[model samples]
Target: MRPQLRLLCDSSFRGPQRSRDVASILREVDELQAKEIVLVAQDLASYGKDRPDELGAGSIVDLVRQVSAKVPRTRLLYLYPSDLSDALIEAILDSGVPYFDLSLQHVSKPHLRRMRRWGDGERFLRRIADIRARAAQATFRSNFIVGYPGETEDDHDQLLSFVGEASLDWCGFFEYSPEEGTYALGLPDQVPVGLMHERIAELREMQDAITAAKRDELIDQTLEVLVDEPGIARSHHEAPQIDGIIRVPLTLPTGSFASVQIVDAQGPDLVAQGADSAS
Candidate 1:
């Protein structure tokens, strides 16, 4: 049996037809008996924003509640967008899933403006703190683009500072790539490719250390993890495929949930022993 099933419901999941479409899909998957159902979307919080659902479930919070009620047996998860409003953040917290995959390109306000995004470093930090305050075990992941057009030394420093302060569970730093017909292509002061590489390397190193430190904190803690395969599993703190995985005994069955105690931290990944074997 497959460990989990992922449904890619992008921006197309909108308008009055959304409810019927979702119902149909859920009905079809009900027989699969998958361990987890991950609803992958660009901005799940923005669901039904432009067009309200015909059934009166007009927000992501409503959608999640509906799905949970329908699929009470399977675990549900979704991806988050970068531009999260206060209402959306509250909705996410209420859903009882503390994992956040914020697609924030950059935290520097000036740089974000250049990228046509929102939120500054300070604002992002405050929001993150609020989430943690509400859910101590909450996990956060975000991506940043290094060396955007007109990116200054101060902007890069601000990003570094934010990474240290935020202490996100997962982070991805990519060098800026110019695409055809994009606004960045016409922008002046494009950073050199070599400098972009250097900047990304710095970000990667700093974030790697932070991620390792955070994972180390989980050592000895008993967690209920879902085994994806014979030797790989993950708790809510780690997303499937994208984030680090937990190494379990080969005897563990795939697509099964087991209680494990984290035994060691291997940088980003972790080593865990079954609760029965843990000392």
Candidate 2:
């Protein structure tokens, strides 16, 4: 079986020169006959925000269209940073792959301001609802920082509430680590290390339950999964490595698409068996 290709597009890729090179990149990938392509970007929504003309397109939506035209047969997945917008969400849904990797550092309004990011829990929840409304099978993954400078109890509570309400398919919580020459390092009221650990533990516990329940919901349902290896497969709901995997029989060949019926849920992973079709 051919190996899957992962294309990493960093912030520099958003520039005009690099943006224009996307076509050639797609052409190369096509020439290689890659069966699957995972497009990793810092912020896909900001693809052409800096200079649309250089991209030869107005937005990421146009880029998605271009990819589909160029590699219609290959499966495309996106791993992007959290800079979501209505248009970007629409574009992702249009791509027929509804997996979302939102890098929301934190969601409290004040803490988000400190983190130099935008959007609060309320705004994010609304967007999640909108996506779910449009695509019932959509899956979401996000990461959050637990203890930033000046993180208050209220802020923590807000994050807990958001975790409960969002019901994301996957979540990661990390204790803040001050980096050299960063604004956060100079901020006052740094959270104690012990407190940071405690906060992260609480957040992880809540999200774990949510993730388990989400996985449980898939039991008895059939899905089209791409077998990564002898015993590991993934449906559209699971990303390549960061999310849970669908366990399948060893008889399934690697890198082949198969229909499987989910027979059991094991926390983040699901067990499946060969099936004729989705039901």
* Cα lDDT over the full model 2: 0.74
lDDT of 1 at 191: 97
The superposed Cα distance between candidate 1 and the true structure at residue 64, in angstroms, equals 1.5
Q: Which 10 consecutive positions of candidate 2 have the poorest summed lDDT?
A: 72-81
Candidate 2, residue 123: lDDT: 82
Note each model's CA RMSD in angstroms.
4.0, 4.0
Residue 215 deviation, candidate 1, in Å?
0.9
lDDT of 1: 0.73
**Top model by lDDT, which number?**
2
lDDT of each: 0.73, 0.74
Q: Summarize candidate 2's per-residue lDDT along 194-275 as a digit string, tens digits.
A: 9998989998999999999999999999988878777888887887777888888888888788889999888788989652
